[model samples]
Target: MGGGHTGASERASARATERARSTRLNAAEKEKDERQKNSPNATKAIAEGMNVISTTSLKRKRSVMKQFRGKESIFKRPEALPPRFKNKDVPDYHKHPHKWVRYTLGDVSPEDMSDQSNTAAALSFLRELKERKELIDTNNIELEVPPETL
Candidate 1:
């Protein structure tokens, strides 16, 4: 009877130790998981994995401004040439005489005329001046000076 009681006590103690060890292991695993979730490297790896999955289903976006790349000058000259000058047979001089005049008057350089808005504005101002009879010379062949002189 004494031996039987000792045996039962030993078995109970062994089971209690096993239960404690298992709980400790569970706590340690939970802590490890928490640490991994908070680590920068682990977070980055998870993000990269998600990106790969998303990229497979989603198309890459292209910039609308990408078309404008390497075409800075084209934006400056958006307006089409006049109909009469649209013909390939028209001489370059006849195609855009105002550009030449602008160059001669020193109001703008060839490079400056690349900006369509500025060129159009300047040409419209000159035309308006001519219409108002504010120009000293109306001849298209010569550089005209505004009465106000600059």
Candidate 2:
């Protein structure tokens, strides 16, 4: 009788484990189906510009921020489709509207010398200066130039 009871308990335990596993699998399948149904519409709307991603992203960000209080987002920045800068001739489309002044390095002041055109000059100057002073430290270097000098 004890042996029969042990056998029955083992069978019951096995049955419970199988049922739990099946339940978990079913839940996972349901979630996948829900995602599939929702994803198509989301993608279509995004493609059509009918759906702006910012709201959804903001919502997700808010939820995530709440979850971690002040943690940084884990999602990698999406690669921007190379700016359709309508005019590719306009060098940097990424700069802000207010930063229109363009300057090469050394065009204005040593500080502004790091601007795109002046980079070579700035580098050459630094290299020459470094050669003249074997123990020169870069930490003391300071730049004083307005952004518009270019």
Candidate 3:
């Protein structure tokens, strides 16, 4: 009986030692910086994730009113181009362009913008500038689209 108790204690001690070693190893792994492990791939992943929601897919959004305002032009013409802005004029109620920079996802820094969750920093920065009354809205007028009065 004495020999059996010693053998059981030895087995328990061995298991305790193994458990301690495993716990220490896991701690060491966790101590390593998360940024280091994810590195460059992490940045790329974040950018790709952000692009999944931006302007590139804007055309896919559906508009409720598809009725033509007038008869279509008979002559075949080239597609209308996006608005041309040689110099973008913001409002006095808005932030100066210099104060607010555009941070494209995959090409921008989170430090410049407020949201750490997504690459919406550029938009956030613009809104903040406008809120601060640093921008002027002469060339930066907002157009009101009248709702369809059914």
The regions of model 3 sitting more than 4 angstroms off are: 33-150
Evaluate model 2: give its lDDT: 0.63
RMSD of each: 31.6, 23.6, 37.1
User: Which digits, one per residue and each the tens of the lDDT, describe model 2 over residues 63-144?
Assistant: 5446445433334668978876667665563556566765565446646544775787788999998876754443234234
Which has the greatest lDDT?
A: 2
| Candidate 1 segments whose C-alpha is farther than 4 A from its true place | 50-150
Give me candidate 2's TM-score against the actual structure. 0.28
Compared with the true structure, all predictions reach lDDT values of 0.63, 0.63, 0.56
Which 10 successive residues of model 1 have the least lDDT summed?
A: 56-65
| Ordered list by lDDT, greatest first | 2, 1, 3
lDDT-best of 1 and 3: 1
lDDT of 3 by residue, 25-101 (tens): 56644643453335555455467874544332233222211322353432477889988784686664475667676
| Candidate 1 lDDT tens digits, 1-150 | 899999999999988987876776568567667865775656676879845333312221123234335742312556886586445587777878866753364766776667896878899999998876744444542555565765
> What clash pairs does model 2 have?
102-150, 103-150, 104-118, 105-118, 106-113
TM-score, every prediction: 0.32, 0.28, 0.25
